[model samples]
Target: MERCNHGTIMRVYRTRQLWGSGDDTFGRLFWSFGPSIHAFSRTVRPLILIDGTHLRGKYKGILLAATTLDGDGGLFPLAFAVVENENFDSWLWFILLLRQRVMPVDKNNNEFTISSDRMKGLLRAVAEALPGSYHSYYIRHLNANLLKTFKSQKLCKLFSRAAYALRESDHKEAMELIKAKNEKAEKWISEIPKENWANVHFKGARWNVLTTNAAECFNNVLKGARELPTAALVDHTRWKVQDFFHFRRKAEATWKTHLTHRAEKWLDRSCSFGSKFLPRTCSWNEYEVLSSTHTDSADLEKKTCTCGLFQTMGLPCGHAIAAMGLNKLDRYKYCQDWFLASTYRSTYEEVIHPTLDRTQWPEPSYDLLVLLPP
Candidate 1:
C-alpha cells in the first residue's frame, strides 16, 4: 500500500504468546493515506478530533480515529488505527504514531488542538505523547455526565451556556447562574480546568468546534463497515475517503463565492450586524465602533477588535466590519485563507488512488510473514 501511495504510512505490530511458541499475532495496525496527510498539512485547520469506537468483527477490537474539519466545515478523517482495546497503551501508541507520522510540529513551532470525549486514558495519553498540543474536552460528553450525575435539565442547559460562551464575562455570568441554582453542580464543573471545556479560556484556535462530533459523525458513516474483518474494514475506509475527496473536488468548482458557503454566511451576518454600528476614525487603521449599548476599538492593520471574535475566529467581527466599511476596505481580504475556495480546492487537489483487484496484485519483493490474529 505504501509503495503505491507515495507518502502513505502503514505499520503492523506483532506479538507472541506467553510461551513464545507460535506464529506472531497481530497486536495493532495503523495506517494514514498520502493524500489525506498532504491535504491536512496544507489546508485543513490544525484542530483534530480523536475518538474510539468498538468494532464488532469476529475478533473484537477498537477503531481509533483522528478527524478534522474542512474549509466548508465538513468532517475530514485524517488517520486511524485498530487496537486490541481502548486503554492507555493503545491510546498512547496510536497518538505517538499520529504525532510522529501524521502531524509533527514543524520548524515554525506551530501548535494544534485535539478534542475528545473523556475517554479512558486518552487525556493522559495526549499529555504524554503530545505534551505541547492543547487538549479540549467535548462539551456534549461533559454535559451528558452532568445530566447523569445530577439529573437536572436546567443545570445541563446552564453548563452548555458556560461552555459555549465567547467572552470571559459571559462565561463567569453563566457559571454564577449555575452556582446560584446548584452549588454542587458548580463544584463538579470547577473540578475540570476551564481551558479544556470553556471556549473563552482555550489557549488554541478550536475554530468554534467544542465537541468530538466530527469524529463521531465519521464513525456513524462507517457503522456498517465496523462489522467487517480487519483488512476489509481498512479497505472500506479507503474507498469512503476516496469518495469524499472526489465528491468535494468536483463540488468546489460549482461554488460561486470566494470563501466557502459557511464562511460567507458568517461574514454576511457580521456585515448585517456591523451596519448598525457607526465607526469613528482614530487613525489610519484604527477606529472606534459605537453602537447603542457600547463601543469597541477595531485595529484594521492588526486584524483585531476589542470584541475578541475577530482574532479568535479568523473572521472579522461586527466592529471590525464596521471599521472596514468606514475605510472602504475589502472585507474578504481580512478572512483567513483556510476558509477560501482556493484553499478548499487545494485540499482535494490530489486523488486517492484505488487499490487493484486481488487477482492482479503484484508479488512481494521481500519475504512475507504469515501472521495470525490475536
Candidate 2:
C-alpha cells in the first residue's frame, strides 16, 4: 500500500484495532487507484456503482467496492474498502473519503449518480455523505425483494418491464398489467421509490446501468486474489488494473470508428429497429414515428422522442433513429461525448508507475493511527 503512493496512485491501506493500541483484531482498510482520480474526474461518466462481498479468508471482512463507467461502457474501479461489516459507519467512512479524494461535492448541483442494490446501511450513509447526489437502486435486487413478498416469475417479468420503461405512459402500462395479475404485486412494487428503479424518473445519467453488475464483474475478476493476504491481494489488484489500462490503451489505438464499440453496436441496433418503424415528417423538425403497436412523436431539434428513451439513454431510440434517417441526420450527433473512442482512449492515457521498495520509501511526516471499532 505504501509503495502504491509512489507517483500519485491514490491508494489507502491500513489495519486498525477495535480499541486504539489495545484490541488485537483489525477493523478496516481502504484502497484506491490514485491516477484514476484525475482520469475519471475528467474522462469517465459521473455514474458510480457500489457493492460489498464477504471475504472468505483467514481474516473475515467485507470487501466494499466503488466503480465507474468508462467511455466504452467498461468498468473503471475507483475505490475499495475492507471493513468489519457492511454497516452505516463503514459505508459512511468509505463514501466520505471517496467524495473528498475523488468524487467531490459539486457546489452547483450534484452531478454524480450512485447505483447500488440498496445494501444494508447504504441508503442512510449515502443520504448523509452525499445528499446532493442521486441514488438509484438495482432493479434485480428490488425484484428479488418483490419475489419475497409474492412468488411468481410472471410478476418478476412484469416488474422488469415496468422498471425498464422509458416513458411514464409505458411504465404505467406495465404496472397496470401487473395490477391486473394481482393488486398486491402492484402495491408492493409501488412501495419502492419510483426514481430508484424507474428509468423514466431517474434524476441523473444512469448510462443504461440499471444493476450493480459492473462492481460484481470486477469482484469476479478479483476472485483469485481474495484468498491472498491483505498485502498480496492489494498488490494483485494494482497489477491487474495497470495491465487493464495498458492493454486497452494499445488496443483502442487501432480502432476505426469515432464511437466506442459498444456505442456503435447500440446505434446499429437502434437503426435496425428504426427501419421497422414507419416515419412521417410532420414539419421542419418534427416527425411522427408509427409502429403497429405504438406511436411516438420525435423532435429532431430537441433531440427527444415521446417514448423518452432518446433523452434518457443518451442514444437515439428507434423512433428518433427513424426520424433522423428520414431527415438525413447523422445518428452519431445524438450520442453523448463519453461514447466517443477519443474519450475512451483518453481515460487510460495516463499510466500507473512503479513504486520504490519499502526500505527505500520516504518516512511519513506524521504517524497515523486508527481507533478501535466501536
Candidate 3:
C-alpha cells in the first residue's frame, strides 16, 4: 500500500486523516509515477508521443496516452488518461496532460511533436490549450479519407498528388505544386481554413507531419479489447500500450522512427481548407484514365468496362489498374468509392487474418459519385 499509494495508506491508517499534501492519493501516485516514467523515457530521448486506446475488458472506455521513443529502437510509455468517450472534452484532458509533460515551463522545448488526424474541432481545442506547439495530421488518415471521399479513380490520382505534397514538404505549397496537375481540388482552398495548411520551420524546412494515425493504430490494437470490462479493459490497455511500445521498439530496430510524425508541426492553422464531395465527369479524351473517348462505351465512363469488374464485381478490374497506370496513377485510390474504407480491407483481409477479418462484406461500388459527364 505504501508503494502503491506513495505512503498515503500509511499516513491515512495511522493519522486518521485524508492527506496533508495538496494532491490526493491518486494525484500523488500520478505525479510520482508520471514523472518517474517520463524521466526514464527522457533518458532514452525527449519525445512524448500520445494517443487514446480503447479498452477490451468488461469496462468500455477510451484510453488517452503519451509516449516517447528511444535511441535503441525501444519505446517508453509516458502518461495516460481514460475516458468514456472521444469528444472535445475527453480529448482535451488527454491533450492537457500531454502538454504539461512536454513543455513544463512553456519555453523553447523542441523535444516533442504532436500528431493526429486533420479533425477540425478537436485540433482547434488543442490549439487553444497550447499555443505555438507543433501539431500534425497522419498521412494515412488523409489517404484513407481522400480515397474514401473522392470515390472517382480519375480524381484519385490528382488528389493523391496533392496529398503527397502535403505529406512531403511544407503543406502550404500543396495547391502551388499540384493545382496545375489537378485543378479539381482548387475548391478545397475555399473550403478548408488557412491553418490546416500551415507549417512549422524545422531545421531549415518549413513543414508539418502530425496526425491521429498513432491513436488510430492504437485503436486497431484495441479491437478485441473494446468489449471487455473497465478494470480488465484498462489493465489490458496498459499491457497493450506496453506492447505497442514493444512492437514499436522492434519496428524502430528494423526502421528509423520518430516518436511522432511530421503532421503535428503547426500549432496554428486556418480553417481555409474544406471538404468537397462533387463528382467530376471529364470527357473520355480529357479523362486520361479511360482507355478510349467513347461515351457509348457504357463500361468506361461508368467506371467499368466489358470486364464488369470495378462497378459490378466490386474488386478492381485488372483492366482498370492497367488503364489507370497508363496515365500514371495509384490503383488503390479508386477503392474508396466502393462504399467505405472498411470494405477494401475486407477483400485483402478476408483471406489473411482470419481471426480478425470478416467475410460477406459489401461490394466497393454502391452509388455513383455523380450522374454523368454533365
Tens digit of per-residue lDDT, candidate 3, span 1-374? 11322211110111112235332222111211332243333243333445655555553555665554332323344554555556776566556655554344434434344555654356876676665655544545655655676554544444444443422243345555545545555555336443343332222111223345445555566677667643344456445544544454344344322212111111001001101111123444222232332221123345543423344323334445445433455444443232222321121221111111125544446752321110
Q: Candidate 3: what lDDT? A: 0.40
TM-score of each: 0.95, 0.87, 0.46
- Model 1 residue pairs with clashes: none
What residue runs in model 3 are displaced by over 4 Å at the alpha carbon? 1-36, 39-41, 44-50, 53-60, 72-76, 101-111, 152-177, 189-213, 240-374
RMSD, candidate 2, Å: 3.2
Model 1 agreement with the true structure over 1-374: per-residue lDDT tens digits = 77667798998877653225656888789999999898888898888899999999899999999999998999999998999988898999998888888984572223788899989999999999888888889999999999999999999999999988877788999999999999999999999999998988988777778876799999999999999998899899999999999999889889999999889999999999999999999999899999998788999888878777887788999999998887689999998888999999999998888888778788978988777888
Task: For model 2, state the Cα shift of residue 196 in Å.
Answer: 0.9
The worst-scoring run of ten residues by lDDT in candidate 2 lies at 9-18
Where model 1 places Cα greater than 4 Å from the true spot, the runs are 16-23, 104-110
Best of the two (1, 2) by TM-score: 1
- When summed lDDT is taken over every stretch of 10 residues in candidate 1, the lowest stretch is 103-112
Tell me the deviation in Å of residue 75 in model 1.
0.7
Q: RMSD to native for every prediction? A: 2.0, 3.2, 20.7
- Give candidate 2 misplaced runs (Cα > 4 Å): 1-26, 104-109, 276-288, 363-374
Model 2 clash number = 5
The best candidate in terms of TM-score? 1
